[model samples]
Target: MKLLTLPSFLLLFFETAILSNFVTADTNVHYLDNNEFFKFSNPRQIYGTKPLHIFCYQGKPKYIIHIWQSVILYINHSTDDYNQFDGGSPEHVEKEYLEKRYSWTSGLFSSKSKTFHLNPFNTSCIGIESQDTYSVHLKIIRVDLWNILKLVAGIVFFLSAPTLSKNTLFHYVCGVSSGVCASFLILIYFLSKLFPRKTFMYGVIGAGWTLVIYFLQILWDNMKTILSLYRTYVIWYIVITGTISFILCYRWGPVQNQRTMNLIKWSLQLLGLLLIFFSSHFQEAAMAQVILLLLFTYVPKRWVLAPKMYWKKRFPPKLKPISNDEYYEQGVRETAKALDDLRKYCSSPECNQWKTALKLKDVKRFASFIEGNSHLSDEEILEYETSIREEVTDDSDNGEDAQFSEDESS
Candidate 1:
């Protein structure tokens, strides 16, 4: 073959690059949740692609890990590797293909902008070190596991409270039913805020809605009986409880501090319990049932389950490794961009640690795997990053000052 000029070679390479990498749908990826496995074709892009087109506040992408046939993945923070995965790596597939993106809202409004397209990882024409291009030996130092069963139990009790309302509280059952549904709805909203990524968020939201629908249907069926109870005494109960609940929620509902909010919530719950006990319609059965509902619905979740979830979310969990093929997937790329936006909020040391850990083929690959799976929105992620940075910096300064004082005394 005749020698081509450097520019001509580059142009030809670019032209052929569109066909250089081909990824199959069967590529498996491990998610942070240990029990879950993801395929390359369907990477869990939680924030979706809409945020990618906007450059202002992108967040961390899900981690992309590529491996050769002998693949064992691990994630390590500091010196410890806490998680490991084994993907069947019989052989490597090398084929190049063109990629494009399609938005869910494309047809809603006419836009001339073409979806982003690229060619990813066709190693046929070039040779790169395996260690540089893939995760050859992976180790993860720290990861925390969540108890899904506890969350499920909380949800089940929350949804079942309506059933318990039928026999107890007598004339007050209607109000109690409505109140139970409303309280669970509020709890669901708080869980979504607290553990956005966990299945608990979706579970509570769906179950809460189902409970509301069930309650409304029952209310409609028993409207005549319920309204009959709405005479002077019952009406008074309705008005008083409703007013107190409303005032408590309205005043303390928006408070961002979790501990403070929980304190207020528990105090109000105790007051509600006392009110129900002393109400004219109260029966021993009603009191007992109410106690069970509260025990199952609020007690375990607020005091036991939610705090664990909050801890996991605060520290984040393990990251799974993915391949270059998975990294180049449309969903992965957008998520990676979002992750980068979130990473911008981390401290320089943390950011540098990310760079060292991910050893991605490009900066985009390095952008993968945000601290908390990008569950928080971009703004929230930034706030988290800022607080973490300040805390770490302050601690470091304190350490330095103590060291200096000791040295001076010596």
Candidate 2:
């Protein structure tokens, strides 16, 4: 049985390989037109600053187009016209700038034609231009059914290789194989835009084999018994859900406040566990529960949270401390202001009555006397009052005739 399996596997592999080769041969033919021809020139007037060889194509959404170039030269693609390269702009002044610009591919020396696969996402037009002085002839072809079939074949081969083994570790092997295949799919999808088709295929095949061998060794050494009980499955499911929740929280939780971030993290974790628990109990609603969990995981946080919640608090700036000289200056200014206000108040007519009520004619003298003498005997206070009254009587007697004449004139 082992010998028969080996021969059958080889036969199946060769059959698929031969069929793929036939498909490639048939799809290699392309229809050409004179209008498709483009010329790139290094004009002496502009010093090769302008990209004369530009081909603009109307592109559809989610469609990938393949480009074949006849010369070894750097290529770039943009969603708009290549008018920016017409002048000696800062963006294209240096040779290295074109190499680092958007959707740029480095030049490679090759005997065969170089191919570029592009996905023009949502752009109405795509402009393909050569960054070098070399004259480039190229063809643009939209990916057709046969090309898609070839891609699907490659993907299937990558995913189905591990299943060929008849070992009891089928589940573990298939899991690892699928993960590696998905990673390669994403990598190839992006790399197809940056590398020629031949270079992209060579890299994918080489990297795929290396990872497959490494993962196989890991699986061989770590094989364990598979738990088959329903209760065990439930516990594993809950643990998996909790772990996914934790990762999501840490990656996409609120960052405006630390406390809010923690609250959101814990809430999501608890909610994930509860959903798993309830889904297990209510088997009929399990699908709905799973859908809800997926929505919570993938939905944009801004759509769920208010716009104001994303705002961060701005703290007031720190003030510099005042020096000793500054402090003394401030104190002097305040004291001068207070004395000016008191002088203005004393000029008013109410000042005489206030001074009489306090039995103090001059505010400065009253303050000095209080500071010097803490207490006074009753007779001393009486004598002080009698002296003030006798002074007042002398002033009144001196001004009596003048005050009486002024009143009569009024």
Candidate 3:
């Protein structure tokens, strides 16, 4: 006799082709974890210069041209490895930026730096870090004026192509609007990272959203031509279901729990596939429908960049220390509350053991805090660190979320 868990049982019962579809769908979606990269170097060697590369956020991953946000390249001058210039450890590096840690304010390394913005769109680092200098290189994308022009021009050509060298004025206008709006939306996302000042940042976001609404209006008008009653119901179902699922996962999902993450991730893939399949069914409106869905998904989420700094502005509470009891109880899965607790951990006088101190919760905002601070009691820190080590070493733990559907074919 054999007993199987839901995912296993389902996998066994389903046809190989249908199971393959599930696997393929899961693999196609991009996750931030899949792209993380980091490196540290001697500060002086990389000082006063810039290196160029594209990032993942700018577009889909490309050879060397895509903007990437997963890796962070940091140069600490106070390290013992390089005594020629003043070298500092990661902890020492954090001290210099402590005042700005929890706020929405954004700037470069220091006042003496040449670059005004830390995450400049076109250039890499353009500053100095002699006395405890920290030149941070993050994986971020920048869409500049030239890139915008090129994107708009390309969209115009593509929209005109199907018309066989004689495109209607309305089509040309829509193409131009599509390109300009998308590029500007990208610009807003980049600007939010480079300079996260509240008023300016939110203003750009509001304007960009207005443009998005206008674009959606255009798509809706076109959608009416080809959408049958059945397709309309399917689209509305997807829209409502997708919106609810997104809210539930984003608002309540535990950041540290692998199980919750998997559920949210798979749900997104399913929704994306369903939406695309339905949208593409109407040949007359297929291109517009897909384009609208892509833009809708991409535009809003782009501003929520990785790395604690880029997202701090989204959370506005002042950073003050909280007791461990206060943290685990009231702070569990609450971003603002967890961040405040992490601040307490950072501000602790003994904040050098932070990496091994706190437990991993969903509030990844605490990552930078842990990097250089460790203020827990020795016993507490030891316990936390030991649990982390144990978890890392024990690698045979793979489980799936609960079952969702029946086997269509066996």
Candidate number achieving the greatest TM-score relative to the actual structure: 2
Give a tens-digit lDDT track for model 3, residues 338-368: 7667777666776765564466553354555
Q: Which of the two, 1 or 3, has more TM-score?
A: 1
TM-score of 3: 0.15
The TM-score, computed over Cα atoms with residue i paired to residue i, of candidate 1 is 0.16
Tens digit of lDDT per residue, candidate 1, span 231-323?
675577567667766555555443455564455445445555554443312145336645776676657456777878899999988999888
Q: Model 1: how large is the Cα RMSD against the reference?
A: 37.8
In model 3, how large is the Cα lDDT of residue 172?
Answer: 40
Lowest-sum lDDT 10-residue window in model 3: 25-34
| Model 2 worst lDDT window (10 residues) | 63-72
On lDDT, the stronger of 1 and 2 is: 2
Query: Which candidate, 2 or 3, would have the higher TM-score against the true structure?
Result: 2
- The runs of at least 3 residues in candidate 3 whose Cα sits more than 4 Å from the true structure, single-residue gaps closed, are 1-99, 102-123, 126-410
After the best TM-score superposition of candidate 2, give how far the Cα of residue 159 lies from its true spot, in angstroms. Answer: 7.6
Model 2 misplaced regions, further than 4 Å? 1-35, 45-55, 61-114, 120-133, 137-146, 154-162, 165-410
lDDT of each: 0.42, 0.44, 0.42
